[model samples]
Target: MKYVVAWRERPTGSAAEYEAAQKRIREVLALWKMPASLTIHQFVARVGESGYAALETVEPADLQYLIAAFAPFSITVVPMMEVLDVAAGEPRGIEWRNGLPCTQP
Candidate 1:
């Protein structure tokens, strides 16, 4: 499954504190060797915002580990299933049902 993991660094008392937080984040990633199951599509900081957004294709079983890897940062994980393929002209008539994609007759 694919997941979007968005995170924002928690506010800190000083620049030193923020730098420490960054260091911890890097350490955690290195410690885990950056999970082999995850295929990162995009990982970038949000411009004009103090946060980051990452899109990755990951196995469901590895999801928890992915979340835990972020450690102390405020993070949100959204499970996503592609229901449309604009390039392929898929789901010509589909709709969102209760926040999920569904085909319409």
Candidate 2:
């Protein structure tokens, strides 16, 4: 299954705290290795304060490991389906739902 993973550092009380948290985050990054169970499609960061990634894996435990490994940051994991894949699904029984397009109709 595919997943969208994102993380952001929690708010810090002061500049010193921010620096300390960043130091810890960097340390974790340096020590961590990508899990073999996951396929990384993209890994990116924004302004050094947050990160985003697209990953696919058959093992759900990989996500649990990810959260534990990056404990310093707030993490969110979402299951995703490609838009085209969703659009290509059978349209049966969907016509009654308003605002939805049904190919069969």
Candidate 3:
């Protein structure tokens, strides 16, 4: 089972502590058994306000392990399902090819 793990941080009263904690977090994730083929990063728009990360090939049980290991930080996990297309030319079933060889019939 694949999972997309998004990591977001809450605003703490102390800026110094938050910065220190955030740095520590980077080290923690680096040490974790994260998938090499997935994308992971902190939320750009809301820098320092919140962080974000996306992960794949992770199990539900692994989430619990992560949360426990990274105590005091709020973590959110959302499971994703792969789209196995049995009927199709495209998974979404949408085509917009005006001059291409493959046109919708």
Model 2 TM-score relative to the real fold: 0.80
Listed per model in order, the count of residue pairs whose N, CA or C atoms clash below 3 Å is 0, 0, 1
Model 3 TM-score (2 dp)? 0.50
For candidate 2, the 10 contiguous residues with the lowest summed lDDT are 90-99
What lDDT would each prediction earn against the true structure?
0.68, 0.88, 0.61
TM-score of each: 0.60, 0.80, 0.50
Ranking by lDDT: 2, 1, 3
Candidate 2 steric clashes: 0
- Model 3 residue 78 CA deviation in Å: 0.9
Clash-forming residue pairs, model 1:
none
What is candidate 1's lDDT per residue for 11-45, written digit by digit as tens?
88998988898798778867675558778787787
Question: How do the residues 1-105 of candidate 2 rate in per-residue lDDT, one tens digit apiece?
Answer: 899999998899999998998899889889899789999899999985788999999999989999998888899999998888777763544544655665784
Question: What tens digits encode model 3's per-residue C-alpha lDDT throughout 39-63?
Answer: 4433333454545555554445656
Q: What shift in Å separates residue 101 of candidate 3 from its native position after superposition?
A: 47
Give the least accurate 10-residue stretch of model 1, judged by summed lDDT: 87-96
Give the candidate number with the greatest TM-score. Answer: 2
